[model samples]
Target: MSEGPLYPPPGAPTPEEPAAGPPAQPAHPAYPAPGTTPPPAGWAPYPGAAGGPRPGLALGAAHKPGAFALRPLGLGDMYDGAFRIIRFNPKATVGAAVLVTAAAMVLPLLVTAVLSFTVGLALDESGEIETSASTSEVLAFLAAYGSLLLSLVLAQIGITLVTGMIVHVTRAAAVGRRLSLGEAWAATRGNRWRLIGLVTFLYVAFVVVLVVYVLLWVLVVALADGPWPVVVWGLVSVPAYLALTCWMWVRVYYLAVPALMIESAGVFGAIGRGWVLTRRAFWRTFGIALLTVVIANVAGSMLGFPFSLVGQLATVFTPEYALLALVLTQAVVSVVQNAFTAPFTGAVASMQYLDLRMRKEAYDVELLREAGIISE
Candidate 1:
């Protein structure tokens, strides 16, 4: 029987020519053939066949596309990248984050409850706001709040550092093998101190950069001998200054932590290794890191827009609805803010340093081989 619509009763165009067989090619005259196996991954070319290899037969080896495109990295890009990584490793990323989030939320409430009880006791003893909760009370509240906030920030930083190391180690593990929950915990545990020191160094570096920038601003303002021309020159140089600062940090620290962790080196040694590895490819390194940021931001916006839309929709109803809308709006904003930032942060952690190692150290091949995805 004819193959229905596809065959059209015997001989139609046979639905796009029944897939062409390999084309015929006359041999090239006076071509010198290559001797020996001609090395791996360089070139093999098409084998010489009367009619070259069948058109349907796939050629050579399949290859992955190059690194994500180079674009300027931004805050938004990091969040977008984080979410993409989250999607890929939902169990490790979202699952662990949810548990961590719950802990963060509950711990604060618990502290608040205890502090409220303590405040109640103070009120009972003193029996007057002015007397009981005077300067001491005010100062106590300020101290408590300040400590709480600082501790929260540091805890989050620690969590971020640990989470990042876990994610990378997990991803690399996944390429060739699977990791149990216990195994992930163990890998992170093994790497914890190194990761913490790495995180600490980065944190300090960021602060130092800020301090330097502030100092420059002060210098610029003070050195401005009372005219628009000096101010204009100073303003014009801000971009250059910012770029130089960024370049310096990336040059000094880009792959340092990874090298430190992988090689177990000292801080200065790690910095030197990173510099050497990233030496010749500053722009490419910058571009890939930047592109990762761009991709991440786009992804985060795509994710966050929905929550923000729902929030905006709540505003259309009434004044009472407005209060509810306000709460909803803030909640959505908080979530979207976090979502937007998390991805690129993760991406930066993953890609920039990894790219440096690959380019400089041939670590990518070692990585691929270690994962058993490639052999030599």
Candidate 2:
């Protein structure tokens, strides 16, 4: 009342002065405090700023502290962010991919080596099967073929696991955090089995679809009165089957792994989540997936060509160690090819998942909050 005390009254806890040093900067300099001076003209507001534009409202305002901006990504953004994720944390992305690929190739390499050697020994100098070939030789070849199939199944399982791991890594990168391989692996603990089950179920469904298609074709052939009917049936059904398969893959299966890993969903739940996310966005999802596949395949083929050429040359020059040389070279090719392709595909899928979530659910707000770029 008297205005005598300009400051705190006696015994009142006075505000402490800041420590003597340069002024502490805001955690996010881009997002200036509310009611403060607005940014200069043409200055885009930081993403998730108070009263700032939401994702679709102003994509230019989106902030990117990690792999991608916290907004719906364009095609270029998706591709660029995929590569950024790989480059940002190679230890978790590419390194993990290489290790998984090598491990997956081990049994396949062994089986191929054994098969080649057995078949080689069974043949005469002219490379014709010997008339005196033993039953064991034939059995060895058969067993090796069976083992090769088993190895392929195991390799697929390994790839599925690594896909989940890459999803985890991408998630961390989105939040501007770098996850180590062990941390990514740890993040996938409970979801690994779910991922495996999801992949297995998809494969089984694919096989069932093929079997049914084949059976229907057989029935068509059996019932047809002429070869013309058979030809007509094939002409109509082949493209339909292929279209259905591609549709299922792009619209239904593409997002399952990200859903499973990010949402901790069950096998079927993740599948349904993917289906839901793709609603009204089929073309976008399909385009992104198709482009990613083409890029990965081209890169993989390019990387594998040199190794393949070397293997062929080694086989031509050193016929005695041809099998071993070819096996080793193929294994190397697999490691190198998958090391690049797997992570790239996984990152693209993850980017798609984030983009979908941001478009549908305003997930950028949550992501920004989690990343500490915005206050809760």
Candidate 3:
């Protein structure tokens, strides 16, 4: 009946690990011989399981009494277990997403403003605009707007990196290690440029796909002079974009920042290393993220509902309230949407980071041993 701080609650433990400890050393009359089958459902020599020996020590658990047990949380197990995490560990998921989204909101505004002003200043002084209405002035406008656009894209990519770091922290935190935004930020300090390059590469690839799509649509429009071909093109394009969306996500999302933060991988090394880790685990990664997104969207809807109702009423009845209504809607969307959803994105990223590291490093097991959750 006791599920202490470390002891898993019901549904947490697998059926094998008894509520009580394992048998004593002398309780065993016989040990298995080499090259022979061990016990049914073989037990890994977990360092700190009940009746288990410490590190480098071996222990066996009996299953149906015939075959050796497989390792806990191997790839197949992790794939199956990911949803269990989303159901049980949602707090970690959102906590991670929010940190990243908040950074996106705060940092980009400052970055865009500063970069825009610098470009405007350059246009006045050196871009060779004879007057404010000149082409250089026009370029200045583009620069300012482009800065904003670039800022948004950059924020998205940075959030991905943040996702990786948060994942790293969550994995550690699950094992009773303390973690914080400051620690995650410190881990990201020098890695920003390489991460940016990775983001840029993926962005360019998407842009090229989009451009090709646009051209094909334009050609279709010119030739058919009817809407049906255009409609067909649009239909085909949806899955094209979906595939690419999943591509950049899987290839580069966890690769850059998580690899660096958790595995201490270098910039280029992180890319190759990430691919290696993610190649077969795409759906597991996607499922954990997809669940986070769904929960965040639901929570965001709950948060936004009130504001949306007020906004609708404001604009419908009050003609003079137009400006006020518009601003209010914007405020409502930001306050509600970001507040509820950002953290969820960060947390999902965080959990994914933990799963990756646990598979690669078994740090969780070591951590369990150190925390006395498992025996030495």
Candidate 4:
């Protein structure tokens, strides 16, 4: 090579300097020195560092440029992160939830009104069923009922879309970005059908399993001749059925939607990914999921209680308009419940997916790099 200049080129290491290699191991292991790795974009220096904390170094602990620290999350982190995601971007989370919930409920509400009207036509002024109902009225009533069922199916699809959107919102928030409703919608658009398919498959499978269990219970009861046999079968079979269903629900389906949304996995792929992620962590995953559901449900019920009480009072005080009052109250309750619980549950599921990946796949390092806190 040509003779080197008096000093190394501006960016090159000199003789006394060691060539850049893996970052130096910090003296404290947990808190790396600020200078070693650049801080995440917009990150402030840790207080009391030599000059100031480096841009990338976490102030006092783990780097958390978003809803949570870039490390395996604790239970508190999961819950807090869920709330933070919604708070950080209400337009994407709660606003989308409200719109989706309202849209999903619309058809059901209309079908309910039609069914109520049709049924009312079949009832005499005395509130007794008319024995001479015409074929047209009967068909209309049946059609309304059929439409109600179809609306319910469509509602399930809408719920799936909301869940997928929330997953995207949580993912964006994790990277310190707040997605708008339209952005979240765009992010999830490609995965909507896959999510719906996954949910439909799960629902159908659950129904099939329940039917089989019921048929088996009936057969067992029919084959046995004594009351003691039925009681004994109920005692053993019911617990077994419940346990099996709960286990499958937790181990197989708990993380499927998140996998589908985040990994762009197909229906079966999402299920398989969920199964793999939960391997050797069944109890942990189940406990967290169950607790989240319980908390969401309890909070929803508490929030809806006022409306429910108002509905009850309305019915008691105004019998003539009782149905209208109850329907209106129920609608309000449903909106409030869905708006709050949907996002909360979706956030928890997203956080769980992230936590599992970090724990098992060293995902936090990748996240740090993606956040530009470190070089490739």
Candidate 5:
């Protein structure tokens, strides 16, 4: 060889080296460090992966595709995906929420106004301004309160119905599709009755719990020898009852709406499915549901705070129009808040439901197949 020696003396340039040339470059500088084995081709980090993804600057190579960015998400994926869906299909998702919110809000207010006017007329006619009010007056007051409660319940039902439509639209969006308002409504047609029935069941369950608690208090009042015993009984029973009620509600109905809407299950079937799916994942489901609600409430409160403050301030400066301003402010705030929150919440809940399906049934495989990422 034409080298100074077989190899140059320690650190000296060999015949293969170009003396005084530009610095040498690696063919693949991005390769793993010296003495380390490179990861297998196409390997990447994944949720619940074995030892996690190989350390590298490359993006996830093994993150299989789906309708959404990635299918079968982990907790964070589902949480983040909820908001993503909102952006993905705002018209169907947010528009539907806005429309439902408007109806749910305005109709209730109108009913309250008409009912209040009628009640006021009745009271004025009774001419009971002097002395104590009559039994009919007391009954009228109760009726007013009852109507208010009914309006609230109706509003809740409307929200729940809209939530079902939102889940429907989101599922379509997840499959690389969109739904028109009519299409979403049409999709929910088969499930509307089941949806109402499921909500009714939950309400009935809650009423039953309340009635049972009331009966227990009545018994305590009748049987207890002293006020101390009754007070003690109330103290012990109330918290326990409330805790049990909350736990039962979370476990039984966390997935009920999704099951009814997505799986097309019946009311009782949805309840049973929710119970089964939540059997081992109760806390996870509950945490997600609770987190969604808390976030929505916090966001809504933040958005409405300024408007509410304005309404309150206007009461002092413009007393004549304060009531109108407050009412309109509340309506506008509620509508805007619901528009954002309802769809986002529904999307989050539906993702949680999808997560359960993936964990329990490998639903991701089908999603991937539908997205053409896999065959058979």
Candidate 6:
């Protein structure tokens, strides 16, 4: 009977394949009703043998086809790429950072100490301290502090230049080119002092803004010592201070360094450029910068902690030896810390700049063209 029914089974459809043709649909059926549509031929609920979502078509998204594509970067890319750039060319990225950092730090300290001692000795020998203790001592103190300030400014300038070098080197490496320290310097050659000037200008601008805010508060207090002063402080000073600080540091100047280094922008140009680049992407850029700073600090602490502990321990037993050891250890740790951290910061900045350009200006296209990956 079953063998005979095998031929008679054409009368009704099985559960696996529904019967075709139009029919009255069921209100509450266990299966899809008659005339119900099926997926088109060669189609699927999901693509591929593994039944995963279709490539490029799933979720209305497209895949990036290559590495180092000039595209809007993800937070992970911004982060991981920071270390990737360092890994790509450690000699250039880390070496340049270490050397420049050492110079920037040690030179200033040396100059400040030597000049202070010299000024103190000269004042002592001239007997100027005895007659006019106030005047001579003030002069000596001013000279020492002035020298210190000068050295600090010089050190900052060196750091600015080093930042430029790091950007150039990391950027080059990102696009598959390794650079030497000299080559990285050359990439930012004519713009070294310009970068420094841009940084200094920004610093001055921030200070000016702070001073203006302070003066406004002072003026408000001088005009009214009562509730009016309290009202102004609450309504104007506090909110304005917070808003302007966030706007300037986080939104305005966050990308200025990269703009100056990568685009050869002037001081004011860099500020404007950074403002433009950070538009509508404040949180992402802020997150990137914040994460970079945290990572850098953590890494620096990790590197320096051992040396610091050893130095402190040694000092309890042998002071003179510990002093020498501590100096050497700190210098070594500083170099190591900067070597890793500087490139990461530089890479983060460069990545942010590139991502901004890619989003705003199709900068990846230009980069690809420059790298000969694409035709004009």
lDDT of 3: 0.50
lDDT of 2: 0.72
Which parts of model 3 are misplaced by more than 4 Å?
1-165, 223-237, 254-256, 264-268, 316-321, 360-376
Positional deviation of residue 282's Cα in model 6 after best superposition, in angstroms: 2.3
Rank order by TM-score, top first? 2, 4, 5, 6, 1, 3
* Prediction 5 global C-alpha lDDT: 0.63
For candidate 4, what is the lDDT?
Answer: 0.70
lDDT of 1 by residue, 140-202 (tens): 455445544554565466456545544453333222222223433444544466666775787
lDDT tens readout by residue for model 6, 1-376: 0000010011223223224444322211133237744432211111011122223322211122122434688878777666655654565677776766566556434543454345432233322334544665466555544544564465456556778877765555444444545556656756777787777787888999889988887777778858866685778668878777777886777788887777667778888899998989887778778888898889888987887787666555654233234444555666667777777787788888888888998866655433334443
Model with the higher TM-score, candidate 2 or 4: 2
Which digits, one per residue and each the tens of the lDDT, describe model 4 over residues 1-376? 0111111111234224234454322211134465666544322211121232225434443367567777888899899789877766677788877776667567646754665555543444443335687777566556655654565466557767888988877765665545656667766766777888899899889999999999998898889988999998899988999899888887778899988887777899889989999999898988998999999999999999999999978767765444445556766787788778989999998889988989998878766655545555
lDDT agreement with native, every candidate = 0.47, 0.72, 0.50, 0.70, 0.63, 0.59
How many backbone clashes does every candidate have? Answer: 12, 0, 22, 5, 1, 0
Residue 32 in model 6: lDDT: 24
Candidate achieving the largest TM-score: 2
Scored against the true structure, residue 185 in model 6 reaches a CA lDDT of 66
Task: Report clash pairs, candidate 4.
Answer: 38-56, 39-55, 39-56, 40-56, 46-53
Candidate 2 global TM-score: 0.79
RMSD of each: 14.5, 12.9, 12.4, 13.1, 17.1, 20.5
lDDT of 3 by residue, 175-210 (tens): 422233444444455556666666566567778878
Give the 10-residue window scoring lowest on summed lDDT in candidate 3: 61-70
Best by lDDT: 2
Is 3 or 5 the stronger prediction by TM-score?
5
- Give the poorly placed runs of model 1, Cα more than 4 Å off: 1-85, 111-148, 170-174, 294-344, 347-349, 373-376
* Candidate 1 root-mean-square deviation in Å: 14.5
